[model samples]
Target: MNRKSRWAAGPYILWMIIFVIVPLVLIGVFAFTTDAPFDENSKRLTQEELAAIEEEYAETDEELPVTYKTVFTWDNILSVSQYLPVLFNSAWLALIATAICLIIGYPLAYFMSRFRASSQRLVQMLIMLPMWMNFLLRTYAWMTLLEKNGWINRIFGLIGVGPFEMINTQGAVVLGMVYNYLPFMILPLYSVMTKIENHTIEAAQDLGAGSIRVFTKVVIPLSMPGIASGITMVFVPAVSTFIISRMLGGGTNMLIGDLIDLQFLGNAYNPNLGAAISLVLMVFILLCMSITNQLDNGDEEMEGKML
Candidate 1:
């Protein structure tokens, strides 16, 4: 409302429009349109043009189609239908990773929230220490450790157990995702849980709430916003990741991100197809965020009604 506020917000608003809105518009244009291709044998070309082309390329058999004009079509989007299985695999893997994060993070977050200030700082630093390493390098370290003769297999060898294949599997991909994104889940839950006062929890206990009852009815309900935030944060990146799947799954587990990457930068070399896949991914992420937002709002409304 104030001029000072407007001035401060102007650059951020401009940045969003230039970066986000323009890119989405360009992707949509690419997804919905293509260069109208014509060949000498095609009926769209005139007979005279066909004769002229035959005379021109008589010495060689290399037939090059010419771009006639740009036309709008649904072919690019429709082409994505065949890749739905890849997309679904990405979603399923992401869901598994997110659920694992929540299971491991919820208790860790609660315990961290209950810590003394110094201890909380120490524990938080420990959680964040792994993230200081490069993402690619962290993944590489996992690769080294998960190899056939790696440390894990050696440990199993000492116990008279055979070394099982660990790397280049779906399990490896899921492990990478959980290891990398687990912190994203923990920090948000910790941030929200730390705000819940001890007196409120004690009051629930005073009213005959057992440990499980207090956690389910009071703590979990209050932490719904953080749960939603954590899911969105973890799921979005996990679903779109190509490097983890490629490296850990040995390129066999191609997710939608790998499919899009191949179309743009691999032997596929089709920017139009890549853009269409990116558009679909963007829509998927938005729908996820929308659902999370709805959950957050519903939780708020329920709390308001209770009060």
Candidate 2:
């Protein structure tokens, strides 16, 4: 890039430094440090000091406020073991949702990619139409459809199946995640699949490869970039989601996101612990992305060798 291109990136660099870099530094600082001890206005009192202060204040009919000195501690991160189940649940659910999205999305993308350009555009619009609505609203819409007396049950009732409990369950949370993030999986896969030339598949068929073999050996390997990108895009948000689990899982299925929210905003009110959880979650997401990148690289290398 030239000097002008570097200059054009100056605003983006400043924005990232101010918003991303600074906030991460602050979270790191808070995660490592606790309150400082013994300020001029707030001092830690010993038992004897407390007794003396109490005795002196007893005459005055006023009580002194107690304050503890802040210090660095590892308890916040160490205690994360207690919330290990929540982390596991988050990872498990996100994985399940990502897998479901991939299973459904790959076929859909493949089918859509074979359509004419105009038809593909129309289908793409339909796939993306739901996303134009607010995410909260879309999740709420699922709540209405999945609730016991919701539309799904009502339709099932006509078939003599009566209502079944659907909302406020792990399945509902997964449904919500899949519903919201499926587009993320589909669009990337479609973008990559559409770029594949028809002549490549034709050449494979000319070599006596069956439809299934051609798809497995040719189309999928070529679309690995989209697959990796979609997995990362879907899994990261699904793992960190709090609102879907809260609204759909009925607060019973507390994922890591809920735990972090509780630490910062709920009765827990511990920002240090929240920061620790956030840091761990960030590491998990980075690890997932790293694995995806490795898989993508491996696929590229294999493809190169085949060529």
Candidate 3:
């Protein structure tokens, strides 16, 4: 690159190193570090206790057990079983939410793409409008709307459905995820669909392909890149999001993010475990991105074949 371009990128690279790269490195280090909670009478060393030992290792007591020794032991790695359930649950929830978003968002995106410019602008405005307000506020608003005695329940009561529970359920968690991430799905798909060649669709129809055939064999294939992009955008954040899950799903819905939070701030007090979980989460997202990129490449190959 030219000198000016290199200079322009220098600040961003430095900032990234100072902020993102440094924090990630620290997290990885802490992941490997020993971290356990303090116990007044317990014979075992906690994570915090282990960290303290390393920090004060220079104090020199040949009698005291090695802090780094126990901290990086095989037993500690095996102890990650406690976090597995949460990780599994988080993955399951994210997959379900992504599938639901794909189903709903594809249709909306298609509609938005096919509509007139003025109408499309209005629809886009409606979709983007929710983002103007705080996301947490929107989740809280849904809580109020879905509570047993909330607006929906009151309407149901009039029809004799009476006291239907909505808040604090798995359904509530899914609802929050879909509500928050639907736009991510729609926007990508819409952008792809809007750029789709009108002539190709018409040509397919002219060649005796029905509407369904045209959609499935032509439009859908062309839109695969957008679909993959949307899924990655929605699924990654959904897996790591704790706020909506905590507020909507309540006690029953325990996700990986919640477990990570508890490790750092809650009862777990094992920042090592939190760091481990975060690293694992990053790996999962990397996998998702890899799959999406593969799909995008496949789409490009197919597009090349079509041309």
Candidate 4:
């Protein structure tokens, strides 16, 4: 709040302006610009040179005058409709992964929160252990396990069930998203759940509430912040994931992330389109966060009214 505090924040302000704000501005510029760069050489040509070239070419009709300046265009953004399938696939899969994480994570967090402090610490560490490894390496390990002759199939063989196709499927991609993002869901829930005092739940039960009623009416409403945070953490990355779908889904189940990658780096090689896709994805994520915030705010209001 003082001059010294303002000075301390200078570096962070400069860092955000340079890295975050500038890049977003550039992406916005690129998204609205034509893919082709303006050719300065064409502008530099003299009228005489142009006339000579036209005469040599001997066109049957008058050629339209062309400008050699970059112009804003909406084609890149509008073209996103062509990739609707990929976009839908990404949204649908990300939603499934987020739902799965919530369903599995809430109960896990609730159970873990009831443990002693020492045991809770151990459980938290165990939940976070897999995250210490590189994400790419972890996804690759899943690929190895899901492949035709992978460990899963070997286990199935021992059970006389033989191998079933697992890798290169939509289910595999969703599984990878859930596996990687589950901890994001669990940690937030666990943190919030641990902060809930036992007295609150006891009071709810004393009021003749059943276990489900206590959880729904007391525990869940209190933990809405964590639920919102976890959903955002899990859903955003799952929606934008390219590597998991590429490696585990074998490139067959292309998501919006893959479409964006292809535009910038793959055969498509269109940065303008990539920027457009990125902008749309950013808007979608912001919308999701906004909805989550509304839900969290509603829960807080309801909790206040109850109190």
The TM-scores, one per candidate, come to 0.90, 0.89, 0.84, 0.88
- Measured on C-alpha atoms, candidate 2 has an lDDT of 0.91
Ranked by TM-score, the better of candidates 2 and 4 is 2
Write candidate 2's Cα lDDT for 1-307 as tens digits.
4777778889999999999999999887777766543424666555677677667767775545545666787877787778888899999999999999999999999999999999999999999999899999999999999989999999999999979999999999999999999999999999999999999999999999999999899998999999999999999999999999999999999999999999898999989889888888888889889999998999979978989
lDDT of 3: 0.85
Model 4, span 92-123: residue lDDT tens: 99999999999999999999999999999999
Off by over 4 Å in 1: 1-16, 38-65
lDDT of each: 0.91, 0.91, 0.85, 0.90
Error of 3 at 56 (Å): 20
| Alpha-carbon runs more than 4 Å astray in model 2 | 1-12, 36-69
Model 4 / residue 203 / CA error / Å: 1.6
> Per-residue CA lDDT of candidate 3, range 236-257, in tens?
9999999999999986798888
Query: Model 4 misses residue 115 by how many Å?
Result: 0.4
Model 3 poorest 10 in a row by lDDT: 67-76
Clashes of 1: 0
lDDT of 1 at 110: 98
